[model samples]
Target: MKSKKILVWFRNDLRLHDNEMLVEAIAKSDDILPVYIFDPRNFQLTPQYTYRSGVIRAKFLLDSIADLRKSFQRLGGNLLVLTGYPEEILPVLVERYDIAEVYHHREVAHEETKVSADVEDCLWKLRINLRHFIGHTLYNKEDLPFPIKDIPDGFAQFKKKTERDAIVKACFLTPEVIAFVAIEEWGDLPAVEEIVSAEAMIGEVHQELIGGEEEGLKHLNALLEEGSTIYQKSTVKGATGKSGFSSRLSAWLALGCLSPRMVYWLVKDAEETFGTNPHFSQILLGLLWRDYFRFMFKKHGQHFFNDYAMKPERLFSEDREKLLFEEWKNGTTGNEYVDNYMAELNTSGFIPHAARLLLSTYLIYVLKIDWIKGAAYFEEKSIDYAPANNWCNWAIVAGGGKNTGTIKSAFDLDKQFKLLNLVVYKQ
Candidate 1:
């Protein structure tokens, strides 16, 4: 019998622990080649000319890749970093390393799903197997009481059903040791200057906003220990300028550096020891909202790419509206709260819950801009950008989401470029 060589592709999920594909690869193979490809798609601009992933997220992603490499090295393996589409790169790797199988977490969003499918096709030509594990959601789709396509229309209903029927599995434990094969010339992780241009990220970055699984775990610990940050406050308090966010480990979670299960289990463990904190339920509830958005995208594929609701609408082709939309993107809309939020998001890629709602309402209702514009802007700038969460939040605000009710709010001009939710819009 021949020993198997598995190639583990690190996409959004970067951490060593709680990674299903990584665990499966280590268990099934004696030789593993871990690879992280920096896809140009993530760094490119949208149809609106805003970045798909802004400079802030690009920097954070760089940090995460660097940390992931160190993690592999710590486990006696090296991570091969490359720049290109996975469909192009993985085939070359399969040929170079004689890889028998490729392993990765599955992505459900249209664009990501297409990329994975393209890579699968590429690998299939060589008779190599592409194996995927579901790691993105809190509850595994197979475990749902209803099928994924049949997920409830409203988040509250989804929550009720999931709480009654689903279970969040325990986090995967890290392997004590890992097997490796010698592969020379391990690729270098790209620098921030390499991934994004300088002028694209012109504002002062927040000192506290760094990336990687180490930082993610640290942030998660802080959130569990203290309960009054950005994510913990009531949306009313946050919107009315009464409180700021503790932020609930979003950047890390967004990048797959942290696992929701780990967060859940830690909270459960605390309840076991220190008595229950209602804050746990609150934050855990937030995780369920993320689960809902993810499932919704799978339920309704490709509908969010347009203005949503599919009503008769004309393009925002007017030069005046275009100019004003740019201002909204740049945080110069003259509304103090909206400006502050957009400024932070533009500069830091970190927008709090209150800020997200205020900005969403301001952009759609007040500015009379389309919801897709707001969503696209977020898709570009958010460190935590996921198509489902980003678009669904905007859709709800626009009165087109599954069952998210109409948001009522009064709501900007910019430096000429700019970028959803009445609710928390948890990501």
Candidate 2:
């Protein structure tokens, strides 16, 4: 019998450890082709800025793909890099190769969901079976107590239900690496300039962080030992607060270099070792918040894309919307504190979580612009950006995305200034 061939589609789940799809594929097949399609649409989607991706994020993605190639080679497999719509390219691969099935981690957001659907449709037309596994979060989607449609509206409720009544499952072990041809032969990784034009990155900084599974695991281990304990102190202490511990894992998790389930288990282990400490508990709270956003997104679905994920009917003025978006993106709307944080993110593909919430509320509620625009802007620039947390959190502060029907006035920057012990700003 001929060796069965399968294609492992790479997306957010970029690592080999505890990867359900890869394990299943290896169990079922003798040969596997690891494929990563840099869908042009991802870079083409224009968010609040004229360019869809900032240089920092773009550069980071380039580095990440490079890293994946190295890891795949170590594991005895190869990564195929292609630039185009997956729907269009997947079929071509199916015809050219003896593809028995297509395996990948499931995607849930509006855009990714649509892309997966498109890929499924095209593959079905070609008579290729597509297999999707759940591995991103600690809780598997099918195992959730409620269906995606019946998920609750608030994070507190979602967290309570999951915490009290449910469990965060264990991770699956990685499959043995299947040795194959080198990825460079499939297609060379694109240069930063090749992915987007120089004009697209005019004001955007070009410093992207390194990306890959090894880097992701290294980051995860670092957070457990040093990050959780000093999180509050570092953030509160300013410069020292930037402890590489803020788990800088967001970008990796977003890209699938790390799995949320693995993150949860690591945090739990850290707590077992040092949960009694106040600093460690504080760090655990942040991890819980990350899970909270994931739960909220599962419940809300694409409703997250609207101005107010919950209050789609409520509308903002056009002029206010345009001006606010410009100010937030440029980091120069005369609000020095807000500008400071925005400038940090614009220059470095990073911003602390506290700053993220503060600046988002400022842009949406205080500026009275459409929160969707702010979400879009962050999506473009943030290395760790996820649609659910980014968009739903925006709605929460903007006084939307809730079942409570309360649209509180946007956050008061003056109050935030006082809380941060910075010189207070007046209205």
Candidate 3:
């Protein structure tokens, strides 16, 4: 009997450990091809000064793909790299290689879901099955008390209902050996310049973080140690306009380079070994917040893209907004703290969560800028950028996103400035 062939599409879920699609692909097929497609649409840039995926993220992605390819090579598999529309390239691969099935993770964000749908449609035309697994979230949507449509609008309600007797499944043990098909067309990874051009970089160069599962696991392990005081320090700290106080796991978590379940278990184990503190739940809180944003995106499709739907009155004039938006994006708004933080982000594609909230507060509330514009800029530059988290969180902060109906006025800029010892930018 001829061997069955499958293509395992690697998207945000990049790692091998606890990867449902990769595991299932191996189980059901005699031979599997690991594929990562660098879709052209992903490299898109905004008007003139903004990019979709900034250099820091672009560089990180290249490193990740390189690492993934190396891992597949070690396991005697080909991680095919392609540059085109996934829907177009996937069908060609199926027709050429005689692939029996395709396996991928489901992305709930609008654009990501559309891409997946397009690929599915193309695959269906050829009678090829494109199977999807849920890998991004800490908890499966199926296990939630309510369906996605009925998910609670208030995060507290959602968290209370879901975390009550929360049981995360054990990690999937990766197979020691992977059976790969005899293929000679192993594609090489591209350089960062090949994707996003020099012109697309919107700000000063940020430090390039090494990517891949190995680096991600290393980061996770470091945070798991008892002496690591990230939790304690992050709790009381507001936007000191800096990073390094928190788990520093956002980039890896956002990219699916590290599994949320793994982080949860490791931190929980640390609590069991070392004495527990209220601070420990801080990390978990962040993870839960991440999950909530994803769920919110799933429930409220295109609504996330709107501007301050909750408060129509608190808006900047078009001309005024344009000026403020540019200043904020360029990190020249004169809030020295905000500029410093934005400079750090623009330079290296990273900023701490507290700092992010402060900057977002300044941009949305202080400058009266559109939350969507700020979110869009983050989408462009952040190494840890996730659509659901980026936009939805901005909305919530701006008195418009998700379920914050009671918020009417501006955020407490004075309190934030005092906590972080920051001052408004002067002319």
TM-score of 2: 0.86
The count of backbone overlaps in candidate 1 is 12
Encode model 1's per-residue lDDT on 1-427: one tens digit a residue.
Answer: 8778999998989898798898899899988888889888877767877777767778788888888888888887888989999999999999988888999988878889999999999999999889988887789899899997788877777888999988888889976688875788998777777777555666667634778899888877776666433334423343643553344576788888988788778877766765665566766776887888888888777653334544524335678778878888888877666776777777777776557766776666566677677888888778888777787777776677656342232112121113322222221
For model 2, name the residue pairs that clash.
12-255, 12-256, 14-256, 76-178, 76-179, 234-241, 235-241
Ranking by TM-score: 3, 1, 2
Worst 10 residues of 3 by lDDT: 405-414
lDDT tens per residue, model 3, 119-194: 9999999999899898888888888888989888777787899899456788887667899867787776888888
The residue ranges of model 2 lying beyond 4 angstroms of the native Cα positions read: 45-49, 179-184, 204-208, 227-245, 282-288, 304-324, 404-427
Can you tell me which runs of candidate 3 are displaced by over 4 Å?
47-49, 229-244, 304-307, 310-320, 405-414, 417-427
What residue pairs clash in candidate 3, if any at all?
205-347, 206-347, 206-348, 207-348, 334-425, 335-425, 395-401
Alpha carbon lDDT of residue 6, candidate 2?
Answer: 84
Q: Candidates' lDDT values, in order?
A: 0.75, 0.70, 0.78
**Model 3's TM-score against the true structure:** 0.91
Better candidate by lDDT, 2 or 3 = 3
lDDT of 2 by residue, 1-427 (tens): 8778888888877778878898788778877888998877777757455455666777777767878878777776668998999899988987777788999877667788889899999999988988887776767766667877777665567667867767777788865557452234678888877877576577747464577788878867876787454542224222223332354667888777887777777777887876556555544555566665676666666654444343433235777667667777888877765787888788888886667766865665456565667777787788877776676667666556654331232234445545444442222
